[model samples]
Target: MLAPERKANDDFVYHSGLKFALLPAYYLPVWFQAIKGDSAVESGIHILPFILALVVATVLTGVLISCIGYYTPFLILGICLAAVGSGLLTTLGVKTSAGKWVGYQLLYGFGLGACFQTPNMAAQTVLPRNEVSIGASLMLFGQTLFGAILVSIDQNVLDGQLANRLAGIADITPQQIENAGVTGILAMIPSEYHEAALEAYNASLRVCFQVAVVVACLALLGGLGMEWRSVKETHTPDDESATEEGREGGEKDGKVDDGKEEV
Candidate 1:
C-alpha cells in the first residue's frame, strides 16, 4: 500500500528482505572453497547446516506468524540475530574450527529465514486485496535487484583483495593468477608462501563476510522502522466482491477514497 502511514513500514520490510535473501548465497560457499579447501560439491554440502536451518526457520516462522498474528517482533529479532551472526562469521579465519563455522552458519541462516518472508506478509496485510499481489511482487523485485547488485559488488571486492595480496608473492604473475582463477591462486603460489597466500585468501573471504555484517546491520535498522501490525484471517469472498463493487462504483462516480466507492 502506498498510503502515507504504511510507507515507512513497507520500505523497511522490503529492504530488510533484501539482506536476508542475498547474504549466504554470495559469501558462505566461497569461504568454504577458498579457506577450508573444500571442493565445489563438498563446499555445497558443508553449507547444509545453513540451508537446513533456513528451511526449518522459514516454516517455523510462518507457523508462528499464523498463530501470533503479529510479525514485527520476528522481523526485529531476525535482523538482530543476523547481525550478530554475521559479526561472528567475520571473525572466521583459516584456523577457525569446523564447529565454529557450522555454528555460525546455523545462526545466520536461522536469522535470515525467520524474517525473509515478513516483507511479503506485511505487504499483503497492509495492501487492499486487489493490490496485495502487486505489492508483494514489487517487494520481491527489490530483493532480487539488491541480490544482483550486491553480489557483483562483493565479487569486485574479493577480486581486488586477491590481486593486491597475491602481488609480489613468489614467482606467480598476475596473468597466471587470473588465468588459473581464485581457487587456483594458492596452488600457483610457491609452497613456502602457502601460509601467507592462505591467510590472504582468508582475509579476502573475511571481507565478504564483513559485507554481510554491514548489510545485516543496515537491514536491522530497516526492520526497526517497521510498524507494529497484526495479521488476521479476516478476508472472505464476500469482502472481496464488495471491494470489487466499491472500486467499480468509485470509478463510475469519479470519486474514490482508498479504493472504496464514494456514494
Candidate 2:
C-alpha cells in the first residue's frame, strides 16, 4: 500500500509546486537575446531582475513558513500570482519598454520562488521521521521531470514557429537559422529579410511565454485542492504514549484516594 505521505494529496502538492520552478528558465534569456538584441553575457545580465527577485522571495517564503507553520496559503497565492505574471509576460512585444519587462519579470520570479519549494516543505512536515526522505524524493523527482519536459517543449514550439514564419523568405531557410546559432541568425539570413525574421522570432518567443502561462494556470488549479495542514513540529508517537501512561497512573491514584476516604 502507498504510505500516508505518498498519497494522492501529496501528488497535488508536487504537481503544483513543479510548474514555475523552471518556467522562466526556458525563455527569459532567449527573449533577451532574440528580441532585445543582447549578447550572451548581456542576456544573462538582463535577466538579473528575475533572478534577484526569486532569491528574495525564496528567503522570505522560508522565513514566513517557519514562523506561521503553514505553507498552503503561500502556495495558493504564489501560484495565482505566477499565473497572472506569466499572462502579463505574453504581452511583451519587439518594442516593449524596459520598465515593463523588468516589472513583469519581478512579478513572475517572485511568484515562482514563493511556492517552488512548497512540495518539499509538505514532504518534510507531513511525513514521519524515517519517511521524510522518501517524501522529499518524490517531490524532487516530479519537479525535475517537469523542468526537463517543459523546457524541451518550449524549444520545440520556438523552432516550429520560426520554421513556419521563415518558410518563404527566399534569403534563408529555418534550418540555417537554427544551425547558425542564436547570435549568428542575422548573419546567415539576407540583410533585407532581417527585420521580418526578427519579428517572426519575437512572435515565436511570445508563443513560448504563453506556454508558461498555461502551465501556471494548471498549477494554480492543482494548488486549490491541497490540504491546509500546519507544518509545526509535533510530538513523536513514543512521547505521546508515555504521556498517556502518566495520565492513567494519576487517575488510578485519585480513585484509590476516594476509596480510602469512603472507608
Candidate 3:
C-alpha cells in the first residue's frame, strides 16, 4: 500500500502541474486578441507553438520514462522549467514581438508536458493492480477540480484589475467594460483610452502569469516528496502470481515423489 503522505504529495504535484498547464489556456487567446489585435481564429493559430511543443514533449517524456524507469527526476525538472516559463510569460507586453511569445509558449508547453502524466505513472507504481484505476480516477478528479478553481481565480483577478485600472477613464463604466469582456472591451472604449486599456489588460494578464509562477514553484515540494521507486524495479501482480503457481506445482511434484518412495 502507498503511504498517505506520498499519495498526498503525488496529488499535489499532479494538481499543480495541471493548473500550470491550464491557466495559459484561459489567458493566452485573450492576450492575442486584446494586445496583438488578432481575431479569435488567428489567436488560436498563434498558440499552435504551445500546443505542438506540449504534444511532442508528452510523447518524448513517456518514452524516456519507460526506458529510464524513473519519474521523480522528470517531475522536478519539469516544475523548474515551468516556473521559468511562467516567469517569462509575465514579460509579455502589448508591443512584445511574436518570436519571444512563441518561444515562451514552447518552453512552458514542454515543461508542462514533461511531468503532466508522471503523477499518474507514479500512482500506478505504488498502487495495487486492481486499485490503479481508482488512483487514476482520483488524479483526474483533482486535475479537473483544481483547473476550474484556478481559471476562475485568474478571471476574477483579470476582471478586478480591469475595473480598478480603468476606473478613472471617462465615458466608460465598469459595467460596460464587464459587458464588453476582455476581447471586446478595447473596441468598446474610446480611441484615446485604447492604450490605457491595453496596458491594463497586459498588466492584469501578467499578474495571472505571476500567480502561475508561484504555483509552479510550489509543485517542487510534491516532486521532492515523490518516492524514487523505479518502474522496472517493481514486479507486476501477474508476474508474482505466475511465480507462486510454479512454486506450488514444484511442491506438489515433490510430495508425490516422496509418497512413491515410501510405498
lDDT of 1 by residue, 45-152 (tens): 999988898899999999999999999898878777777777888898889999998998898889878887887777766556766677667776777777678778
Runs off by more than 4 Å, candidate 1: 1-9, 12-17, 170-178, 233-263
Report the lDDT tens digits of candidate 3 across residue range 1-263. Answer: 33644665566565555575567756889899888888999999999988898899889999999999998888778878778887898999999998999999999889888887888888777665666777788788778778878888887788887778777664666677678865778777788888987888889888888888887777777787787867776665544776788778877666454456222
- Candidate 2 per-residue C-alpha lDDT over 199-263 given as tens digits, one digit per residue, 9 for 90 to 100: 88888888888887777776666676666667886743534566778778877666454456222
Candidate 2 global lDDT: 0.74
Superior by TM-score: candidate 2 or candidate 3: 3
Clashing pairs in 1: none
Looking at model 1, residue 228 earns an lDDT score of 70
Q: Compute each candidate's TM-score over C-alphas.
A: 0.83, 0.82, 0.84
The global C-alpha lDDT for each of the candidates, from Candidate 1 onward, is 0.75, 0.74, 0.78
Task: Indicate which candidate wins on lDDT.
Answer: 3
Worst 10-residue lDDT window for candidate 2 reads 1-10
- Record all residue pairs in model 2 with backbone atoms less than 3 Å apart, i.e. clashing: none
Error of 3 at 72 (Å): 1.3
- Candidate number with greatest TM-score: 3
- Cα miss at 182, model 2 (Å)? 1.4
What value does the lDDT take at residue 195 in candidate 1? 92
